[model samples]
Structure formats: structure tokens, C-alpha cells
Target: MATHLDLEEQEQLDQIKHFWNKWGTLITTVLVIVLGGFAAWNGYQYWQNRQGMQASALGSAVEAAVNSGDKARIDQAFGDLRSNYGGTLQAAHAGLLVAKAASDKGQMDDAKAALTWVADNASDDGLKATARIRLAAVLLGSQSYDEALKQLDAKMPTEFDAVVADHQGDIYLAKGDKAKAIEAYRTAYQKTAPGVEYRNVISVKLNALGEDVK
Candidate 1:
């Protein structure tokens, strides 16, 4: 009986060895792939966290410079932020802030440069549209009517179409093109929603041009 039990145990051991010999390499490969994937995911998460922290730090620096009322500091800090983290939303906001501060300080060149960068590089259409409008205002203030109109001609977000048309009307009026300005104001008046305060403003502009729209 003991001899029979020994034979049964040996037979079980041999069966396990046969299974291992057939599938051991496959099992090891599967484990390596799963573990490696987990490691890569962890590494990616760490990298994203690090980038967010770095971008936030740089944004804080720009905000500080802007608040200090130092135009040169705003320019320098924004340049650094743009060079290193231009793809971040922080960079977009910083660019706009720097532009506004530069404009307030009468640094038109710096303001234009910063607004241009934001207009060209902002990831969101809304932000890009805002930058273009502000840039057009700056150009219009300098009596560059054609250049301001050129900026306004770029594609705008749906919500900004009416606003852009109105701005174009302002540029045309500034350039003494009453016909085009009237046409633009008419378009703005038509596109705006009824009873909206903006629609009232457009109505005022259109009435000044000797036209009315429902």
C-alpha cells in the first residue's frame, strides 16, 4: 500500500512539471507585460503632476510681476513663461494679463506683441477671439483702420460673430467709410438677439447710421 501511495505522489509531481514545461515561458511573459504597463502608467502620472506644479509656479510669478506695476518685469516674466510653458492655459491668461498691463503703461509695442502671441497660440477659440478683438482695439486706437479690420476678419467663435461685426463697423466708421460701416452695423443688428443689452447697443449704432432692424 505504501509503495502504491509513493507511485501516486510521484505521478502527481510529474504532471505538474509537464504543465510548467509547456506554459512557464508564456506565464512569465504575460506577467512582465502587465507589470511593465503598470510601471509606465505610474511614470506618466508622475510626469503630469510635475508639469502642472511647474506651470502653476511660473504663472504665479507672472501674476506677481503684473500686480507690481512693473512693465519690464511683466515682459520678462511673461517671456519666460511663454518660452517654457506656452501650451498651458496659464500661459494664455498670463499673456493677456501682460498685454493689458503693458497697454495701461502705454507700451503699445509690448502690448501688441503679447496680444499677438495669445491670439496666435491660445488653445481655446474664445481666448483667441478675445485677443484678436483687443488687438484690433489697440490698432484702431493708433488709426490703423485697415490693420484693425484685418484682425477682425479672422474667424471668430460663434458667440463672437456679432461682436466682431460691430467692431468692424467701428473700424469702418473710424476710417470714414460710412457705407461699409452701415452695412456692418446692419449685420450686427440682425445677428444680435432681441432684448439683449448688446442688441440695444447695436440698435443705437444702427440708428446713428440712419437704419433700423427688428
Candidate 2:
């Protein structure tokens, strides 16, 4: 009876050993992959948090400089933010603020530079469209009519179509193409949302061109 029990125990042990020998490496590999993926995900989360905090700090610095009207400090702060955190929303906002401040100070070149950066590199589509529109306006102010038209030619978000059309009308008018200007203004009028202040403005533009918005 003792020998029979011993043989049964040994057989069970051998079965377990066989199973481990067959599947051990695959199990280990699966566990390693899962654990590595978990670690990578945690690392990514921590990195994103660090980026957000740093971006927030830099954004505040840029805003303070803008409010103080310190052109040099604004440029420095924005430069740092763009260099280090260009992918963040904070950087995009800084670009817009810098452009506005520079434009207000009659620094057309600086304004164009800032707006061009935002138009090209901003992650938000709306912000990109806004930057392009503002840049076109700056070019228009300098009588760079062809350049203004080029800026307005880029694809824009759907919400900005009317505003872009309005800018096109202004550019064509500046170029003395009254027919094209009227056509562009009519497109702006038709695309603008009714009751929006922009529609009223477009109506005024159309009236100035002696065209009725159909």
C-alpha cells in the first residue's frame, strides 16, 4: 500500500513538471508584456502632468508680460514658451497675445511673425484659422494685397468660412477688382449666420458694393 501511494504522488509531480516545461516561457513572456505596458502607461501619464504644470507656469509669465506692455519681456517669455511647450494650448494663447500686443504697438513685422507661427503650428484648428485671418489683416494693412490673398487662401474651419470670405472680399477690393469683391462679399453674406453681428457687417459691405444679398 505504501509503494502504491508513493507512485501516485510521483506521477502527479511529474505531470506538473511537464506542464511547466511546456508553457513556462510563454507565460513569462505574456506577464512581462502586460507589466511593461502598464509601466509605460503610467510613465506617459506622469509626463503629461509635468508638461501641463510647466506650460501653466510659462503661460502666466507670458500673460503678465503682455499686460505690463513690456515688449522685450513679452518676447522673451513667449519665445521660451514656444521653444519648450509649443504643443500646449498655453503656447498658442501666447502667440495670439504677442501678435495682438505687437500689432497694437505698430510692430507689423513682429505681429506677422507671431501670427504666422500660430497659423502654422497651433494644434487647434480654430486658433489656426484665427491666426491666418489676423495675419492677413496685418498684410492688408501693409498693402501686401497678394500676400493677404495668399494667407486667406488656406483651408479654414467651417465656422470661419464666412469670415474668410469677408477677408477675400476686402483683399479683392483693395486690388481694385470690384466684380470679384462683390461676389466674395455676397458669399460672406450668404454663409454668415442670421442675427450674428457679422452678418450685419457683411450686409453693410454688400450695400457698399451696390449688391443686394439674395
Candidate 3:
């Protein structure tokens, strides 16, 4: 009986060895791949966190410059933010602030440049749409009617559709296209939130264009 038990145990050991011989390398390879992928993901997350911190710091610098009313410092800090952290949403928000400051300082070209950057590169769709609308307004002020219309024609997020239409109405009115202006005003009126002041403004625009909005 002891001899028989010994032989059976030896056979089981041999079977396990054979199985390992066949699959050890494959199992090791799979584990290595999975672990490497997990490590890479962690590394990427770490890098993103570092980037976010840096971007937030630069954004603060931009705000400081804007507050100081220092046009040159604002321009420099904004350029740095755009160059280094353009992928971050903070960059877009900072760009908008810079554009507003530049516009207030009569730096029309600088304002347009800042707004163009946000319109083209903002991470958020709504931010991009807002940038486009503001940029269009700037262009309209400059009498760049065609360019203003082009900016307004960019795809807007659903939440911004009404505002974009209102801006389009303004652009059309500026261009003396009263028919298109009325149409855009009507669209805005239909899209605006019920009982909002903007809705009332749209109603006024429609009335001005001789289009009754019931």
C-alpha cells in the first residue's frame, strides 16, 4: 500500500511539471503585459495631475495680470498659458478673461487673438461656442461682417443654440439683412427659456424686424 501511494504521488507531481512546462512562459507573458499596462495607466494619470496643477498656477498668474491692468504682463502670461496648457480647460477660461481685459484696454487685435485661440482650442464645447460668439461680436465691432458671420456659423452646443441664434440675428441686422435677421430672431425667440429677460429681448428684436412672435 505504501509503495502504491508513493507511485501515485510521483505521477501527480510529474503531471503538474508537464503542465507548467507547457504554459509557464505564456502565463508569465500575459501577467507582464497586464502589469505593464496598469503601470502605464498610472503614469499617465500622474502626468495629467501634474499638468493640471501647472495650468492652475499659470491661470492664477493671468488673473493677477488682468487685475493689475497691466496689458503687457497680461499678454505675456496669456501667451504662456496658451502655449503650455492649451489642452486644459483652465487655459480656455483664462483666455476669455485675457480677451476681455484686452478689449477693455482697446487692444482689439490682442483680444481677437485670445478669443480665436479659445474658439479653436477650448476643451469644452460650450466654452468654444461662447468664444465664437464673443469673437463674432468683436469682429462685428470691427465691421468684419463676413468674418463675424463665419464665426457665428460654427457648430454650437445645444445649450448655446438660442444665444448663437440671437448673435446671428444681431450680425444679420448689422449687415442690413433684415429678412435673415427676423428669421434668426424668431428662431432665438422660440429657443429661449420661457419668461427669461433674453426671451423678451428676442421678442423686441422680432418686433423691430416687423415679425410678430406670438
Per-candidate TM-score against the hidden true structure: 0.82, 0.92, 0.94
Which regions of candidate 2 fall more than 4 Å away from where they truly are?
1-12
For each candidate in the order shown, give its overall lDDT on alpha carbons: 0.89, 0.93, 0.91
Residue-by-residue lDDT tens digits, candidate 1, 63-114: 9988988767776788888888888888898889888988998989889999
Best by TM-score: 3
CA displacement after TM-score superposition, residue 65 of candidate 2 (Å): 0.5
Could you give candidate 2's per-residue lDDT for residues 123-171 as a string of tens digits?
9989999999999999999999999999989988898889899999999
For every candidate, C-alpha RMSD to the true structure in Å? 3.1, 1.8, 1.5
Ranking by lDDT: 2, 3, 1
Tell me which of candidates 1 and 3 scores higher on TM-score: 3
Give me candidate 1's TM-score against the actual structure: 0.82
**Backbone clashes under 3 angstroms, per model:** 0, 0, 0
